[model samples]
Target: MLTPSVEALIQHLADGKFHSGKKLADTLQTSRTTVWKSVQSLQALGLEIQAVKGRGYRLTHPWERLNAEQITASIQVPEACPPPVVEVHDCLNSTNAHLLRTASLRPAASICLAEMQTAGRGRLGRNWVSPFGANIYLSLLWRFRRGESLGGLSLAVGVETVRVLRTLGLADLRLKWPNDILWQERKLGGILIEAITESQGQCVVVVGLGLNLRLPPGAADAIDQPWVDIRTILGGGSSRSDLAVPSRNRMAGDLSSRLLALLNAYGSEGLTPWLEDWRRWNCVLGRRVTVDEIGQRYEATAVNVTEEGSLVLRRDDGRRRLLAAGDVRLRVRHDA
Candidate 1:
């Protein structure tokens, strides 16, 4: 396997410019043949590399290589879940599918991460692109205590996501109701939690996360809402561009460890302790929005997110309605 530095070098050279193999060898302090092998290794990872007579090699586009080992080293147990165990895949139909099949057989705290998901999905059965080397696609298996249902686990997850982004120095990040993370007003990421109830009413929750580290051409068109990628928020530039794109491995490691820790803390404190954090990063609150539940739509001024995570909205009729479970969509008029 190519070391992280070599992998970073591959991405750095992915820019359109022609980079000589000898130059790459010199930069990476490796033999020319070694550089050639590294290039071949990247090709297997789904990157398109071109080798011309004069031009050494160039990537057709950028790709992110997530680090699994780094993530494994960062797990800290704060909840009653199992010890962290990760399974990294080159491709899969869905991380959640894998978790669903293994939940009964496997212990909790098992994680599945894929380089690409052929059939990733979000709430409401929306298609999520799992492009090779584009972003973070992961599913974590957790078993909570029987009959222990936190009122606002989704909202708490959203708040924690913003905290993770802030830990990376990502600013202007906010949370939409339910479990969506936004950069300014553009959708940045989403969370989906699927719970399986056993015969005895025991529950196993599979939390799936999809984050756009980098967006490829045409992928953005599939998303109906306004969205942004990490590259866009950091500034439109290639990994080889002046700023360094953090290692996907480091990102995986840091995010997973921190997420597990948050879950542990949430297990004890519930959502109340994070109310202020959620409020600070709220994006849809106080906005005129449409809350959709069970095919019925209600338009109201986004008033607040209660301690229980239900959206508290003030309708035009001067009534306060607490939406239990619904699709909260920002009204077109509010954005206009």
Candidate 2:
């Protein structure tokens, strides 16, 4: 968490322009020493701050902030749908972790976001590299009754995220089942769904998403897999400074709105409404993949996904099997 003074100070430098110490202190009603300390703090958070001795301070790249008000106003929800409770944080251990712990307190629905995550997480015990203000770290919470199926909820979330990106004119987007986003066969982002099923007839679902807008310097080295960000997607091999990105605030607004709709209708609708679109964006289907389950690995061709959300595969032995809990990975046949 950043202090109010530091937060205010960053805004002054967000325009990617230099601000003199005296000017910043006057604007913040603080002292030049305080302003210098604030700039040091921002730099510690992995932000590239340039201090040109006499030119004052400037962010290497203009900062794009996540504003709760801006996001809320961009959402197009109806009276019955009432937009979700959107909360933005300067830093958090993890958005999903926070929402899961607090979902009981706010049972209706909520979306949590962070400019930076101190302990960002990914599926299967992976570490998601989250640099301050470089990517989208989001978690959305929804409550489901017992009778309403939680099956395919991850798939639903992934599909909706792909839809949102596609609507923004992002092309060649592909969704890997359970929850991985891909663009041109390189990792774009991923989803991690965590839930707590109560003894009663209720469940709390927290879906976390780490969408890469642009990674900071050296951040990509921490990633284990080949990945690409939104900058590469629409920029077409352009330089970082020259790349033009779609309004992140609008994307956040549309993403939450779509997910809320999916959650609201999922109970009654199940996977029926999302089946077609899911298939449209799916890249795993008809691919020779390895399914890892219960300490065993089986090489099979993915045949289809059942209505209940189970993966169906045809083994190399010419037998079909239904997989409920397994991690599927693409095999020899590389995609274009």
Top lDDT: which candidate number? 2
TM-scores across all candidates?
0.81, 0.91
Candidate 2: give the clashing pairs.
none
Deviation of model 1 at 105, angstroms = 1.4
Lowest lDDT sum, 10 consecutive residues, model 1, at: 327-336
Candidate 1 lDDT, 1-336, residue by residue in tens: 446755656766756467888888888877888888877876655556789877788876544455566678766555554588888887788999889977878776788899878789987678887777778887887777676756688777777677777777688898877778888678889888788887666688888888887766656667788888877777556555324445566677766766676666666677798889888888767788866666678678878877777778888999998876445444423561
Model 1 CA deviation exceeding 4 Å by range: 1-53, 60-64, 79-81, 236-242, 326-336
Candidate 1: Cα lDDT at 174: 82
Candidate 2, 1-336: lDDT as tens digits: 889988998889988889988889998999999999999999888888899887799997777899999997777664456458889998899999999888768755588999999889988767999989888998988888877766787888888898898877788888887778998878899888888876675888888889998776677888888899987778776565334677678788988888888888887788877878888888878888876776777688887888767778889889998876444444424641
Please give the TM-score that candidate 1 achieves against the real structure: 0.81
* Local distance difference test, each candidate: 0.74, 0.82
RMSD of each: 5.1, 2.4
